[model samples]
Target: MNPLTAIRMEALLSGRSDQLGPDVAERLSNHPLDSIDTEFPHYARSVDSPDGIERPTERHPVFFGCYDWHSSVHSHWALIRQLRLFDEHPARSDIVDRIDDRFTAENIAREVEHFEDNETFEKPYGWAWFLHLVSELCLWEDDRAAAWRSILKPLEETIVTLIKSEFLPQKRPFRVGTHQNSAFALHCILDYARTLSNERLESAVTDTATAFYAEDRNYPVEYEPLGWDFLSPSLTEADLMRRVYSRNEFTMWIEQFLPDVTTAPYDTILEPVHTNPNRDEGVALHLVGLNLSKAWCLAGLASTLKDHQYVEAFERSAKQHMECGLDRAFTDEYAGSHWLSSFVLYLLTRNEGGIAPE
Candidate 1:
């Protein structure tokens, strides 16, 4: 097993946004920094893989880079967020210009058409990211963003209907750390729902979450990161529950679902994961994401249960997980760098009311 990167704890725990600003800017600034732009890694079922596929750029007009479709979508979310939060930063004007040019109605219409006849296009993962992109646009103070949001609303309604009808009622959670992970998707969409006051969307997510996870108890907790994992199954569940339940209910729930977050074993979820991308280049990069995402989840969880005995433990563990990967993730192998910054900004610039937009 590869040892953790061993970065200083302070780097992750610090309050200064400027510390990671340059890294965030760089990740979104370049022109499709990885080969996915060239190789076009569109994952498709055999039934859907027809004889001749158009190139990635031709297929995905609005989001055709950053390694994969979902990564490209969230990169857009991150760039919009960075521009809004760091308004006076030097890169702001250029970012504004870049977005203005790309977010045109024609490009957005092409993006909408890309979903034609594809039933499982993006599913909840990519669906959630698209909503996240819209969520940022909702809060952004620019006419260009307003125009883009107008063009994007039809697609948004399409996802909201799909989730309510198909995705949520499956009544099964994808208990993994990757794209299919239900908790991660629900977490992002739920936040988007609350921010936009979409009561229907919010109800669909909370209902599914309660049905899927309300009774989960004594999660294996130890058997996570199964080789190619990227999110903490049990921890992500706990994080989402915080949003669904009141303080007292969530505290009671966490005590049983993960009884060791603060004591004895102190929970294996807290330990920094180690990875050697050289061994399995693609799978190993997930460890970096697992660490950053786990950190944000921990931070969000701790905020809700402030008076619990394990609050400090959650906060400390969050920093440790972040220290393990936040800085290193930026310039690490392309497998990780092309997309990790979106999660980085989402966590670091997180507002007080949990994951809801600032």
Candidate 2:
């Protein structure tokens, strides 16, 4: 049954700033800086690289940390977001210094070279986070923001073009709720597109959303959240649909998509996912993300639908998910630590369709 039916407002986060307590700010401030330059313990797609490809740092100038390309980009997004939200976040000045060092014209140019070598390097996932970084920068409109925007233009343009022409056309929805998940990536892309008022990018994402998900009914939620998943294929799709359809239309569509969600008390899917944290492997730590991701999805859906049926249960479920994953996010496991806080920030901020900036 849909646990979102009874979600409440009290359980919803008051704001993203609440998650950045002194300790949390310190933790976030240091996490990415510690590894933004370290190269190993990373994953890269060599298929797109030369036979003797360089290490992660050598290949990706700016985004070489946090286990993989997308992680690094999202980490950067998290860093900037944290700094923007809190003026006195102990590490604010240092973050600006670090950003200046990494987001230089020469460095971004090298990153563009890498992208040229591998046109579909990160496909839509990394592309989305890159856009997320750009979107965050767009919120600034400072001289530094303008410089960074211009410097990253080539790479940004390529990604936007691919989403409209190449990626969207060839794409079939990936419902796995992982890096390959189309809904999650498209969700990010759509958010970025809307913020910039890029009709081309916005139209492509909206059309793709309609084509891929509009016709779906009786979605198979029972098989959801595969063991290694950090995303909820069902919920992420529902969240995306919320943006694509109007309130009346989305309400109608969501009820069909998750009929079980209409059930009272909404307890069937409320339990936090269990994982064997003793294992430090990346696969084992995804449960933390699963919980946080669900929290944001529930919160996002409730805000979008604005229906009484969900205000209570959705908020409670989101709070529970955040509680389950909060401590686990700051872990010793690089597999989890490097990435989990970013997800936490995303949920905590609840930056729905660009409202945070305004």
Candidate 3:
């Protein structure tokens, strides 16, 4: 059996989400650098289930090139470092090493041998996500400077070449419904450029960021946590709301900056928003809001907006929304139940005299 597939198959059988989170964390601590060099081989072969039969498969003879879970793979490295739970179970490094062996340059180049240059929507598939994974890996582990250089140095040039050759002059907007992917790509470039101090990549990222933010106002676009691929463009506003993470982020971005107000005619309003219907949604919203609102407000108060009025306004906004944004997020079954309200319950339990903004 192919090595990466074999390992993944084993992991799947090992009680994934519930049981393996800690196991994975533990293994990472002991083997931080053990399997750093392994990579999964690209495959084109196929096998029928249980019965011997022919089946279609990826272009590569081993693992599908397009199936590269680069982000998830690299994320393993970061997770090991951050949680420190991997110290007890160091044997798990073998799994990580198996894949890194196949994730090398020669492997990737072979995988992209016939990649098309003119396809307008290159899917971006998993490349940017992997780059972010690499960044997280380097940041958390430290002393992985060589790994960072090995992965990012060549990758940046490849991405920049694509941007200059294919993306720069396209008068038409990108494939509709790909705002998040565009944002992720721009972020990868910007982040790596900032990390490595690469001026060329920085300039390219600036242009891409400007273009992406410009497109924000036209249609409903967001980075939903669970959806796969790009979602369909024609989803109604209500359905879109059901999938969007929070109205809070929308409000935050819209309040200060009108990035792409012209390109997105529908989003011209100052506070376009959405809410998830799951009971857990409200809790998640409050968690995100409190963390970010306090941080942003504190920074603003400390640096630029030191006035009493600005401070009061900021505090009032945070306090008001700390509990109000949940109305649409929570289900009717739990709507009136205060105990179920994450923000309200948190405020009640903490019971600290609140800041008066200034």
Best by TM-score: 2
Q: Per-residue lDDT of 218-296 in model 1, one digit per residue for the tens? A: 8877777666677888888888899899889998998888857555464776787876645746657788888888888
> Candidate 2 overall Cα lDDT vs. reference?
0.75
Give the poorly placed runs of model 1, Cα more than 4 Å off: 1-50, 262-266, 277-280, 352-354
Better by lDDT, candidate 3 or 1: 1
Question: TM per model?
Answer: 0.87, 0.89, 0.42
In what order do the candidates fall by TM-score, top score first?
2, 1, 3
Q: Please give, for residues 96-130, the per-residue lDDT of candidate 3 as tens digits.
A: 45445544666545434423432333335244434
Question: Considering lDDT, which of the candidate structures 2 and 3 is the better prediction for this target?
Answer: 2
Model 2 CA deviation exceeding 4 Å by range: 1-12, 46-51, 262-267, 279-281, 352-358
Lowest summed lDDT over 10 consecutive residues: which window, candidate 3? 349-358
CA error at residue 123 for candidate 3, angstroms: 3.7
For TM-score, candidate 2 versus 3, the one ahead is: 2
RMSD (Å) per prediction? 3.8, 4.7, 14.3
TM-score for candidate 3, please give it. 0.42
